[model samples]
Target: MAVTDPVDIRLLAALADLGKTAVHELAAKVGMDPREVAYRLVALSGSGLPLLVGVESDPQGLRAAIAGAPPSWANRPPQQQFPAPQQFAPPSHPVPQQPAPPMPPGPGPQGVPSGPYNVQGAPSGPYTVQGAPSGPYTVQGTPSGRYPGPPPRPQFAPPPVPIDPAVSTWGLPQTASWARGDEPARPAATGKRGKLGEVMETQGLEGEQLSVQLLEVQDPADYLFGAAGYRLEAGERAVVVHTEITNRGSIPFASLPDNYLELLAADGTAIGKAPVSLTSRPPHKIGVKPGETLGGHTVYVLPDATRVVSVRWSPRPEPDERTLTWSIED
Candidate 1:
């Protein structure tokens, strides 16, 4: 198909996946002009398809236009139902779309960072989180006895820039109740703490807590990292993992797992069992209650300081796990 086809598909997919989206992000993700995304969004919205497009700013003042919620396009054109592509039409009248239930101000389940929720927008202090990053990066194929069709993969699924929810300050969850304090917690490892999954058909629990920190959209490159190292000697050469965990959520979150560190190759390949790196801390489970945080670190000892590649914190429960990643040159 032509390039335009993908844009149409993405517009439909965005609604299907995110529930709602803005025109700029829709355009950016689908490689289309903002006007086009807006145009399609208007059409879809009028046809009873839900979508939201708006402007938001980060802590540093960078602005971003966002959109979410895609409409399904199962039917072909001509015979398919099409709505006017101008104004945003709330789902056809009469059928009456139900209003969202009001959320209470209390400690809720942990989830992810997604919303336009806001508070005073003023930051209180340096907000800290609880655990390490989610599912650590897996090294691409290491040649076994025989090789497969392709090469080893070092895919990078970088987490979204951590966004601190502002709701907590006002005693409400505007963006999410994610245990990670900032990022939404994935159930895969959180072990049933705070999560945001579709429980019911039309209604359920969601991580709708938005902290003022969400206003701070960090530059991916400017992000400071935290790493945990193991089995070290004296001054071999790994950046010390001095970490601090603070609870910025509305509810209490679990602690960093005992096995929260690993020695991976430049491509995130694991070297061995990530030894327990709870240096100078209790040997028990580590945790942070709402409005609290914890900190820990490890001294990295390089076998050959010259052969040193890099280091990082492994995956743990807390959703927005901050980590340290770096490389040493010969």
Candidate 2:
């Protein structure tokens, strides 16, 4: 049967050009898989095409197959390709050497030696020649001409030892052992906490001006939001803190202020504001332009007995240990 498939025809045409090429290489040339190309080649050979004629293990016959001509001289049969061996004539006799031209006379006095003379003309012993090293032969050494090995390595002093940190004044102080009643006193509180409904102006660590006014602190029993599908857990009350912030800085404030607000307990531990309360005005992700006032409320779910004394506000979500805080009391 005739090769009817287009892929088969393309494979046969490519094989005619690149005779006995590897399956992967031919696949890359025709943009097909190697196995698919191999299958198509088998089908085309089984078909009524003389594509294998004049083809050899070597792929050099592709040009002849593509042009519909016989293999070239190199691929022809050995007997018809190369001529018969014939005897060669013996080499001729070597050519005679010509004599070299003589050198001109030296330009020196009759008694003086010149023009690359040997040391035999001089009384040798320990005398050194002008254009040569100071050695018996032309070797690199003292006049005795005995070469020594490389020079000795240099010696370096050891480094000084480092001091211990415990005894060093610049390091941390040693911990003092205290009795049960003699425990170290806690550090005195730094800044005073502000009360509700009080407006305070504070500058952040980044030099941004912020004027905050705490409106109210609401402790609701069973906070519910039917529209956003959120409810307070059992024995958990929602502590909502309402505040208004005015961007008094020269640049616009682009951060979420709610992420920086926290509620601190009596034991110096801080609790983040809860995101479950959806029924609040001015969403937590609040941004304000220069000289513009933006107000928002943040809610937190705390245990019924947990006492939240103050609300802390900072400019960053995760502030460093030395970061400043504005404590607004409830």
**Candidate number of the best TM-score:** 2
Worst 10 residues of 1 by lDDT: 213-222
lDDT of each residue in 1-330, candidate 1, tens digit only: 232556567567644543444455445434456777777777655665444545443321111111111224322232233432333434432333454343333222234211222233323432222232232233344533432222222322222343334323321222323233334435543111111111111101122111111011111111121222233444333333333434444654332322333344555454332234334432323344566544454333334433324333332212232332323222
In model 1, what lDDT does residue 152 have?
26
Question: What is candidate 2's TM-score against the reference?
Answer: 0.40
> What lDDT score is found at residue 202 in candidate 2?
68
Candidate 1 structure, TM-score to reference: 0.23
Candidate 2 global lDDT: 0.55
Model 2 weakest 10-residue run by lDDT: 171-180
lDDT by residue (107-194, candidate 2, tens digit) is: 3333322233333334332334355322122223333433332232232222333432332232111111111123433443334346
Give candidate 1 misplaced runs (Cα > 4 Å).
1-239, 271-285, 299-302, 305-330
